[model samples]
Target: MNTADRVDLVTRYTQEVVTDEELAELLEEDSPSAYIGYAPTGEMHIGHFTTMRKLADFLQAGVDVTVLIADLHAHLDDEKSPFDLLDARSAYYEEAIEGMIEAAGADPDDIDFVRGTEFQLEEEYTLEMYRMAAETTISRTQRAASEVVRESESPNLGGLIYPLMQNLDVKSLDADIAYGGIDQRGIYMLGREILPNHGGESPVCLFAPLLAGLSGGKMSASEESSKVNLTDSPEEVADKINDAYCPMGEAEENGVLEYMEYLVFPILDERGENFVVERPEEYGGDLVYESYDALESDFVNEDLHPADLKGAAGEYVSEGIDPIRERLTEQPELLAEAYPDKYGDE
Candidate 1:
């Protein structure tokens, strides 16, 4: 693809890019590396889907994709995943990511997956970490890490070192573009500043939007009602979406509409399907949306009722998540072990 086409693809579902010029320059290179790292701390939900869908765009745009299962990062930041359970959590994360890639209509084999422990402890990487610590102040490090990590007034030294290591990861991975949700912006900006000091180029950054939870706030894995887990039963999904907070004729902060825009519409567009809002004939019959914009327009115009939108969203999202749910079903122990408190009975 040409630069413009590549730029469109890379920025398709993203909320922001560090610099359009930098991204355009990256596309000119032959298979420039792009990577996103995820700490294995929680169950992968629709929020993860919204972010990971950007990978499909990158792959199609000819950018090399790398997924970092940042197990050590999790341990470093407040020890979110306990030391013993890190392995299980990482395993579950990788499996879930691969399933998401396939569900997004992208070839999972085209992407590279790496665990932090694979090379993070190496002599060279550790040396760089120490170097960064010397130059970066404690306050700056903590500030850079604040949004990406759990904040504590009496924060541990590990949290202080977390942001520095993250900046180094862009260098160690040899990525041309650092990809993640907007919450990682602080860390990536720090990387652009310090990477040159470590013999690495300034990276182009791409950030996807952080999806709102079904309950009208940020999704939390600890709260089952906040978002739909990939392992949720069909009945469970329907119930959650049905009860979700989607105000009539208002798109702002409407999690149901956000799902349709971010997840349902993209999947439908890919599959050559329409967004069908089923309704009885007497109630103006079923409405079909050729695109998300069309659906949103109708929704804003009050042509679509909240109940119908929620019902349609539940069905469409369930279809999109079906394959991943099936894959997880085969390995019940993965979820059962990774999050025993939530899925142990499975």
Candidate 2:
């Protein structure tokens, strides 16, 4: 696919552009294009879907894609200290990646799952990684990656090397673009500078909006209330949505309701006149929006009832996720067995 097509996918997820001219040049170049990936470090959280969907969009556009299962980085970003062996963590990370790939309907065969430690040891990758670490300052790296690092309990040597490894992945993959969450903007910038020094071109960084957790802050696997896992049953999904803290006329602050505005609404808007995905006739929802103004008018006026909105949002989540969830069920034993203490039974 050309740069414009790649840009479209990025816009759909991130709603912004980093570099227009460079993207166009890459598109014009006759070389095949691919996207770089990071490992599924923890439980496959809602935030990961942004990158996954970006990959799907790229695949649909016929771009070559490389997915690196960053087994090494998982240790750095893991919500806890690494075990002495590291094998268990790696195994879990791989399972999460497999489950995620299956859930997304992405072809496992088409992707490359590189363990981060193995990639790090390669002489070429090692040289590139250090080269990036040298060129970028501690301050810049910290600034770009503050969200993850700041939240980390043990920001040690592994954490510092984590960013460099990410930058090198793009160089080693020789990808035309990189996909990540908005949170990874720092790593992408570091890659922009570090990769070029290692004789690789800078890639256009595309990001997706972070989905809100059920409890309202950014969706995190750490907080069960904040997210509905892909493994969640239909009843579980519905219960979470029903319990969603959507105050009337305040969808922005409420995470579950905001998902309807952010993720579901954009997809609905793209459908033009017959956006039944958000406004199913079953709920008296038939949004006729020729422009953003009309849609905003309806939303601000509360023309869309909260129940219909929530129900439609629930329906969208249920329907859109069925295929992926089915893929997840195939590996029941692999899911995170521990639920949040409160909702463990559900």
Candidate 3:
């Protein structure tokens, strides 16, 4: 691919790129690398899958990709993943991420995976953390991590140290691009400002749009109905999609439509398939769409019913995730050990 095509591949489907100029320049090089970190805290869900799908774009553009399984950061963020369970959760996370990468049509072998403990505990990394702590104020650290870490009137010291480690990670990982959800904008922006002082250059940041909850608002981990778990059965997937917040003739804040745009359509395009919305012959038969925009246009024009869209989305999503579900289910011990309280009995 040419420079412009590579740039388009990286920039398309992203909410924002910190600096387009930097991305263009970086693509001119023979190889440029990008890194994204995911703390192994919760069960992998469709929301996580959507973000993982974008990595396929980066890989296709010939960018080197690294995934950080931030196990230590997981515990530091309000102990969401207990220290004892970190190993299990991290293992599960790697497997799930590999599955996500493959499901999104990218080779997992092409990406490098790193664990936080691999370097974060080293002497040099520790000294740098202390130096960053000395240079950064408590309030600044708090603000950078506010959206990501749990909040409290009286937060723990670990929460304060979280963002500092994240800033230092860019340098340690040797990443040219820092890719994550838009919610991570604050932390990455802080990294841009502080990394130079710590002997690291500002990374080209890529932020993906957060998918709205299936029920209508922000996707919440506490609310099972708001998101689809990777392990959810096909019947469960259909039921959740059927109960999703998709309104007829309206596409805004519609999770079903967003799912089709971000997840289903991209995967279909990769497989050289069209999104088929099945309907009875009397209701104008099955509608085939090769692009998400065309489907959205028909929906907004009231030619495509919400029910039809939801039905197709459910099937596509289920089919896409079935391999992952089956793979993880076979290794029941992974989930059981990672989330004992929830999956132990199953």
**lDDT by residue for model 2 (1-346), tens:** 5567755654565644567677665556554466655554445654564456556556656667777766667666543424332454455455555555555556656666666666677887787677667777766776667766544454566667777777777777778888766777877887787676678888887766677777776677677777766667777777788777766666576676556545455445544432342556776747544443454456667876666556656776765556657765675544433222333244
Q: How many clashes (backbone N, Cα, C below 3 Å) per candidate? A: 0, 2, 0
Model 3 local distance difference test score = 0.94
Ranking by TM-score: 3, 1, 2
Model 2 TM-score on a 0 to 1 scale: 0.80
Which tens-of-lDDT digit does each residue in 165-266 have in candidate 3? 998999999999999999999999999999999999999999999999999989898899999999999999999999999998988888898898888888
Q: Stretches of candidate 1 above 4 Å error? A: none
Tens-place lDDT digits, model 1, residues 1-346 = 7889989888887889999988887798879989999999978898898888889988998889999999999898888889989999999999999999999999999999999999999999999999999999988887788888889789988888889888888999999999998999999999999999889989999888877777888866677887988878888999999999888898888888889888988888788989888999999999999999999999999999999998888888888899999998899899988989878875
- Among these predictions, the greatest TM-score belongs to 3
Candidate 3: segments with Cα more than 4 A from true spot: none
- Pairs of residues at least 3 apart in sequence or in different chains that clash in candidate 2: 144-186, 214-226
lDDT of each: 0.89, 0.62, 0.94
TM for candidate 3 is 0.98
- The collision pairs in model 1 are none
